[model samples]
Target chain A: MTFTTFMQHLVNSISLGSLYALIAVGYTMVYGILRLINFAHGEVFMFGSYMAFFAMTTFGMPWYIAFIIAIILTCIFGMLIEKAAYKPLRDAPRISIMISAIAASFLISNLGIVFFGGIPVTFPRPDIFDIRIVIGGVSIISVSLFIPVITAVALVILLYIVNHTKTGTAMRAVSKDYEAARLMGIDVNRIITFTFAIGSSLAAVGGIMWALRFPALIPFMGIMPGLKCFIAAVIGGIGNIKGAVLGGLILGFGEIMIVAFLPELSGYRDAFAFIFLIVILLFKPAGLLGKNIAEKV
Target chain B: MKRNNKLNIIAILAFIATLFILNVTLDPYRLRIFNLAGIYVILGLGLNLVNGFTGLFSLGHAGFMAIGAYTGALLTMSPETKEMTFFLEPITPILANIQLPFPIALVAAGLVAGAIGFLIGAPVLRLKDDYLAIATLGFSEIIRIVLTNMQTITNGALGLKGIPGNANIWWIWGVSLAVVVFMVLLIKSSYGKVFKAIREDEIAAEAMGVNIFKHKMMSFVIGCALAGVGGALLGSLIGAINPLLFRFLFTFNVLLIVVLGGMGSITGTVLSAVVVTVMIEYLRVLDIEMNLGFIRIPGVPGLRMVVFSLILLIVILFYQRGIMGSNEITWEKLFDFKNRIAKKITRRKSS
Candidate 1:
């Protein structure tokens, strides 16, 4: 590939990876705390994008204001989903919770179709994001630059919250041992709720960034990305936060680079993430960054 | 036990009689729905083997079904239809002229799916819980993507049309009954106990001398084979085969039936299969304009799915055991009902 083309692909991978990283954080955090795969997390991301769309169109808010409001709304919706679908079934069998999560995902997407209609909507692009930068004959959109910067900032903030704050300590304690954390005067449920809120807010940011990049909004758009992000989380050692970002970048580059080199297999682009996931799962169930936990017989 | 045997024979006869009567009386549309429900029963039973009986959370049912559907369709399709459908890219020469009878093709499809399932399960069954679920799900997606990319073989996304419709209600229900009987007998055997033991606690089962890998592979393969049979019948019923037909939503529906029917209960799976299939059809009205007494409400295209999903969510949250709660319909229960009927008749005569 030419230098300019290589540069363009690199830029594209970075932007895509940022989105995956943002979504994967939500998946990893929830899995870390609850030992539950929150299948509805992607729907939370989809809700965020749609919220941004509605805030701009229906409420006539400016883009920046709408973005902030959308993230906040998405956080509330995420928590609401947990409370309604997951909270009651906390003590039940794991299968029930998983089924509930799948059902919630279906419900949210179908409801989105019922409310948003099945047709794809054009995402509103503000003038501020319309700017494009050209470096060494490789043109890059301003949003592409903003995505990675925003993701880096979010990752730093997330690290600070998880490592430094009191709630972060509580979260770590809960994830390590739920009953033990409770015995130590930690409000386990409260920490979980906080985790969901933060995770979902990150999903909103990712969703908004994703929509800004793609410029289209559909009810079921989250499924593929959601699955891909989950794969990314698994690849990065499912419960590790920084591993999620690393895995996202690897997935992003793998997808872009595979298609870039082999145009004949471009149709199989979506399958790459899944195939990678299976291989990683089979050969290394603990993941690249995950520590192996022995299965008790 | 002798009296129960007599009652069981009579019940079987009655059921067959009812099925024959319904087959003759129902219109083509309703017959199609009935056949689809029978197919679903086969699929649900097959899935229940792995998910409900063996306790392995596999989400690759769609992939297996796709393999079966494509295999059955390709084998049964005439050269003319194959030629017509492969206008985008010519089909492979070896597959072009081969045509098998529907039943043989369906069996072959099942065998192929079973073999593939064995291969996939050999490596994947080692993973536990959610990891297995995700890996299986990934395999299914890979199958879909491969199908979409391999235009010469699968006709790409354009899909194959004009396959013979050999899936009548009799054939569908006949296969469903055979599957049910096989499952019932299998569950009654020692192997079934082993499966249940694994489901209850795999490590303990392993400690108890059960070969977890072999038994899990058996469940996965058998389940996949039945899914394949269902898919073959479905292809024949629809008279078309496509990658889109075996999308994750199809697996989702089957999963819903298996869960709602009470996971290891054969009777529950069969009953819920019929109910869920019919309900899905019944809810079609929600997607269309329904003109009530006065106001004609505009139809919402995706509202039925919304309602169905909500129901599934509520059912999982509040009624996790579902309608059957792992209970089977036994001979004793049937005999008790018969005895009650006899008592009512005797009391009427006395009165």
Candidate 2:
């Protein structure tokens, strides 16, 4: 591939990878604390895009305001999901919780179809994102540049909160041992809800960015990305936040580069993430950055 | 023992008699739904063996079904039909002219599915719980993507059409009954005990000298083989299939039956298979415009699925053990219930 083309692909992969990282954080956080896959996280992403879409089209709100409103609403919706689908099953078996998660996913997506209609709608792009830029003879959409910067900013803020805040300490305690955390007077439930809120807002941001790049809004649009992001999390060693970012970058780069090098295998683009996941899982189930914790009897 | 044998014979006869009556009387549409239910019974039972009894969370059943459906379709289709379907790319010469009988096709479908399951299960069954679930799900999607791309073998996204509709009530129900019997016998044997042991505590089962891997593989392969037969039966009955037919949503529907029926209960699987299938068809009313005297409710296209998912959520939250709760319906329980009813009636008359 030419240098310009290589640069173009690099820009594309970074944006895609950052979007994946943004979403993968949610799966990792939830799985880290609750050990639940949060299968409905993808639907939350879809909800964010739809909320923004409606705000733009129905209310004619400005893009910035619409995004803020969408993110806040998505945060609340994520919390509501935790309260309804997961709260009651706190002491239930892990399998039951996972099933509930799957059911919740189907329920929300199907409800989306019923309410939103199954037809695909064009995502309204703000003029700012529509601008094209050239760097070193490689032209790229401005959003491609915007996404990685936004992701890095978000991750920095997230790391600050997780590492430097009191609630972050409580979160760490709860993840280590729920009973011990409760004994230490930490509100385990509140920490879980807070984690969900953070995770979900990130997902909302990811969703909006994803729609901006792809520019298609459909009820089932989140399914593939959702699964792919989860695979990214698993590859990064599931519960580790920074690992999720690494995994997402690897996945994004691998997908684009493989398709770029061998155009014939472009049809199998979606399979690359899964292949990476199986390989990573077989070799390093603990993930690259995750600690190797053995299963206890 | 003698009385139990007599009761078993009587129950079997009654079941056959009922099947005969339904086969002769039911309309084509209803019969098709009935056949679909039979296919689900096989699918649910297969899933139950792995998920319920063996304590493995596998979401890859759809992939095996796809394998079976495609295998059965390819094996049974005549060269002329194959030629017409493969309009985009000619089918491989080896599969083009072959047209086996339905029974052989069904068996071949099961074997092919089983072999694939064995191959997949070897590496995947090592992961525990959720990881295993995700890996299996990945494999299933990979199978689908491969099928969608393999233009010559599967006709790509165009799908297979005009498959011989050979899945009559007798054929489907007959196989379903055989599966039900096999499940019952298997669950009663020592291997079944080992499966239960592994499910209850894999570490302990291993410590006790059970080769956890072998039994898990065995359960996985059998379950997959049964799923394959169910898929073949479904494909033949429907007479047309695409890659879209075997999506994860399809697997969820089968999972619903297994969950609702009680994961460890064969009888419950059978009962729920019939109930869930019929309910899916019955719920079509929600999708169609209804004029009830004064007000007309416009049809909602996706309401059925929403409602179905809601039902699943409710079941998982409120009634996690489901209808049967790992208990089987046996002849002794039936007799005891009958006698208790008889005694109650006599006492009421005396009073």
Using DockQ, give the best candidate's number.
1
lDDT of 2 by residue, A174-259 (tens): 88898999999999999999999999999999999998999889899889899999999999988889999998888898889988
As a whole number from 0 to 100, the lDDT of residue A216 in candidate 2 is 85
* Predicted complex 2: DockQ: 0.83
Q: Please give each candidate's TM-score.
A: 0.98, 0.98
Off by over 4 Å in 2: B291-295
Residue pairs clashing in model 1 are none
lDDT of 1 by residue, A160-264 (tens): 999999999999999988999999999888998999999999999999999999988999999999999999999999889988998899999999999899999
Model 2 lDDT per residue over B1-351, tens place: 898778778878898899999999999999999999999999999999999999999999999999999999999988899999999999988889999999999999999999999999998999999999999999999998899999989998899999999989989999999999899999999999999999999999999999999999999999999999999999999999999999999889988998899979999999999999999999999989999999999989789999999999999999998889899998889878999999999999999
Q: Lowest summed lDDT over 10 consecutive residues: which window, candidate 2 chain A? A: A273-282
lDDT score, candidate 1, position B170 = 79
